[model samples]
Target: MSKIGVEQSLTNVQDALRAKGYDIVELKQESDAQNVDCCVVTGLDSNVLGEQTTSIKGSVIEANGLTADEVCQQVEQKLRH
Candidate 1:
């Protein structure tokens, strides 16, 4: 079971990830990124999060302009270990 943390604003991403069986977690200021398998965000250079986005130890995925399906495909590829 891959644990995935997602930005709170991306409801479509969250639902898509959930449908794919990935555990979805809401991103918050104090959330522990080390505990998750991956962290999904709109972008690493997001003005909303600033420079604090890279705190996660696991793979960090930028949603960018990709659709939820595209995001899911990326995650699935990254999660293969």
Candidate 2:
């Protein structure tokens, strides 16, 4: 699965993704970098869901923190496969 690290609040992003019909497998908050918050999303690949093992990592850096809309847009772009 592809994992994405968003520079924003996980709650906000998760809610937005759920609203967009994306299944949220997991959400984790990690340490901040330069005062910028970060969160990780697991289970991103459609092929890997309840199947073979796979991993991908994506990062989004936003100064004021990423918005839910921005996170969904970026994730959609990356998950186009």
Candidate 3:
């Protein structure tokens, strides 16, 4: 299973992903996302500083208006490629 970094506040998403056998890493600090295959954020502070930087090589999924199932589907789709 691929490793997934998720925001601490998103308990629902974490549980759902874990149920699907994904390795979920609770994102507490920036370093926690270091080796994750994908990251799920709340999108509350995405690009807030208007600065572009690459911290991880994997894709980032914004869990703003989507349900846990939808986010999981997106993760699966991204991993397929």
Q: What's the CA RMSD for each of the models? A: 2.3, 11.5, 2.4
Per-residue accuracy of model 3 over 1-81 as CA lDDT, tens digit each: 999999888999999999999999998877778899999988998752234664887889999999999999999998998
CA lDDT scores, all candidates in order: 0.80, 0.45, 0.88
- Candidate 2 lDDT, tens digit per residue, 1-81? 333443223567767766776655443222222122223333343222233342334443231355668767767765663
Ranking the candidates on TM-score from highest down gives: 3, 1, 2
Worst 10 residues of 3 by lDDT: 46-55
Residues 1-81 of candidate 1 have per-residue lDDT tens digits of 889988888899999999988899887643545578888888844643444554665787899899999999989988884
Clashes of each: 0, 1, 0
Worst 10 residues of 2 by lDDT: 29-38
Query: TM-score per candidate, in order?
Result: 0.82, 0.45, 0.90
Kindly provide the TM-score of model 1 when superposed on the true structure, using C-alpha atoms: 0.82
Candidate 3 error regions (>4 Å): 47-54
Query: Which structure is stronger by TM-score: 1 or 2?
Result: 1
Q: In candidate 1, where is summed lDDT lowest over 10 consecutive residues?
A: 45-54
Who wins the lDDT comparison? 3
Error of 2 at 28 (Å): 5.1
How good is model 3 by TM-score? 0.90
Q: Considering TM-score, which of the candidate structures 2 and 3 is the better prediction for this target?
A: 3
In model 1, the Cα lDDT at residue 7 comes to 82
TM-score of 2: 0.45
